[model samples]
Target: MHRQSVAARARQALQSKPRASQHRKTRGRVALSNNHRAFRHELHYITRGGGRPVILVHGIAASHSEWGHLIPDLAACGYHVYAPDLPGHGNSPKPGDAQYYQVESLLVQLETWIESLNLQEPPLLIGHSLGGYLGLAYARDHSGEVRGLVLINPLYSPRQLSPVLNLMRKRPQLGEKALRATPKWVIQALVHLDPSAATQFSPQIRQQIAADYKRASPNIVYLTQSLPDMTASLPLVKAPTLVIWGEKDLSLNPASFPELVKLLPNAAGCPIAGCGHQPHLCKHQEVNRLVLEFMNSAAVAR
Candidate 1:
């Protein structure tokens, strides 16, 4: 009888070993699913890391590749980052229809992308320029869906345009034709007009920018048209917000920074000295530090 009892104990231990192994395998699969899945939407995005999630949005005429330098840094700092190439830019499909360029339509695509990912928690939304404006609109509509927001050199109004752009706006048809007909060199020249923006690009990045410009010219009209709606939605955003601007930013008016902070109920602003429109590219180290700090503080507060 003692021999039989010992045999039974050994059988039980063998069964339990497999159960323990199975549990570990299941845990690993869960982690893999979170960190390695292709998110389908109008945009093509890259996902990395495996911690609290953060969505990075690029500005007008920019793609997910624009965040190339910043993605690895954020991922290493313990955040899962999703950087999407907005429709009509990067590898994403560019539909000629004006409807897809509307702020509301872009918001819909973003909401769908987030839901499809099935994130474990609400994500931090970060945007630059045109993207910043879209992030504000998203936070306003889905207040409970976002933990926090970071807007880098956000475009608040059409009045913020440079003199060259203002002149272009006066002859919309001619401007549109010229943009669509311009050679790639002209597009590159126009894009690099801002010294701060130009200095940030490597040769590879410059090629990508040139290609994006060719495809994105048609979408520019829609971008300007959506400005009024974006401005209208600013006061409604309820998320803890951090607005970072480049002091030397020529893309958007520095004077509007104070007005932007005042428009949001729970928002703060920071200006990076000697930086321009593309802070994440031009002043990545400082931008990353501030972003991490703001996100951590906001997480703790909640």
Candidate 2:
């Protein structure tokens, strides 16, 4: 009997070993294939709660795991949350095609995935960094598709990007080569240096980010090349928006906050003092509160 019990324990550990964390929810993975390149892989995501839908889009080089702190509460609060890893990030299958990294292709594929869900209502979109940029584009294209928007340190102007990204944008070939050459230990060491985690690093989260960063494809550097001028598109994004920023963000300049807010006609700006680029990570409770308040507003009610 003792031997049998030991065998059972070993099997259980094997089953749980693949999961990144114990986020309370049912998770799923949808496969996406780039027809041109013939590369395909699962698009991993978590869906939970029961009332209105809310979709959380994480930034580049990160995964749905970054949304860990925010998910349980949002799920408990009656929101049917959907958090998916972008095509190449997180647990999603990293396609080999460089074109798959293009903003337009990604946006189209993202829309296709959302449409397949056949949501009960237009979702409330909350996006961070590169995800925020994609969210803005989504709102602009389908103004009536989303009830509200929450942007966290979004990538708007290329000028506001972190030094690393700028180098990638300007020197594409070198950037890809360098990214490929970066050792895991170097990335793990650098993860702690991000101002976003200056307050304290959640060991599991920090490790996960570092691992994902190291595993991310060199092709993803291509995303840095094409940033659309949001000046024309911002006005078209009629959905109610809440722009959240971290005063201490090292990745994107905080100065772009006002500029972004000024452009979104129905948007409001929320700047957290001493916060970093990922507000959800730095000030999750505050981020949740603000999102709840916004979702309950009259504009979003309709």
Candidate 3:
């Protein structure tokens, strides 16, 4: 009876929600104008489809193009997917100040965007790499607003990835250059080296990613060069979580998986076979399957 009642409530909620197309047109205009004014150091985001709202956040030095393959798939599966290029990345305005690049700033912008869009319930927060960490932080900070969380190969700690880079970040000049010079080819080589993630996007898409990165701000790059320790931020997340790791990720030590799993109290663990850092790009079908199953279970259980 309780399950049926919850389903009935969800159905009613869906029925009462505004039409997707109308919301998209209104919200898109608002977001575009906000970006033009360089308001709040916010990022640029694209929304596609309608149904359940799903926000896609990308990892360090990455644009929403990271979710390229999965966006259309998710939309086809009846989700309203919103993917953002965090400030300093893609088309978003990147202020030179490091303070605006902090995780807290991103969270604030996310909250603002959600409110501006007039989304009543918190959307399912899906983040990749650093994005996953942000999702964790956002859920922790705004427990009442989120539906659930999905993290894909997210960074768990600052000390683990590359201590040398972490140390280098202390020197502002070198760090600035490092961030500014981080080319898409270099990033592509680092994560999508394996066969699966390598060829998923066409040359045109690759060119676009390169263009976005070329135009990204050094401040955005510098701040993301070293992953923040999101471990402290984990305890606040109360929603059901899903953590997906690529079996062959060379970026963050795959060994950290067990440690991260234990930290997420409400999380389910899944391994993407034959994939690396960007599983959503490499293993879309498998990822979609896992996500759909997880979401359906959550809805039914509610």
Per-residue error (Å), model 3, residue 101: 2.1
Worst 10 residues of 3 by lDDT: 1-10
Give candidate 3 regions above 4 Å deviation: 1-26, 29-39, 179-209, 224-228, 299-301
The model with the greatest TM-score is: 2
Question: Which clashing pairs does model 2 show?
Answer: none
Q: Write the per-residue lDDT of candidate 1 for residues 63-99, one digit (tens) a residue.
A: 8877877789889988889888776677777766544
lDDT score, candidate 1, position 237: 84
- Give the lDDT of residue 132 in candidate 2: 92
Rank by lDDT, descending? 2, 1, 3
Q: Name model 1 segments beyond 4 Å from true.
A: 1-41, 166-172, 197-201, 229-233, 298-302
> Tens-digit lDDT track for model 2 on 42-73?
67788878889998988888888888888898
Span of ten consecutive residues with least summed lDDT in model 2: 17-26
Question: What is the C-alpha lDDT profile of model 3 across 102-192, one tens digit per residue?
Answer: 5544554555566566675568988887788778876776666788888898876765464554565565467668657777687445434
lDDT of model 3, residue 250: 66
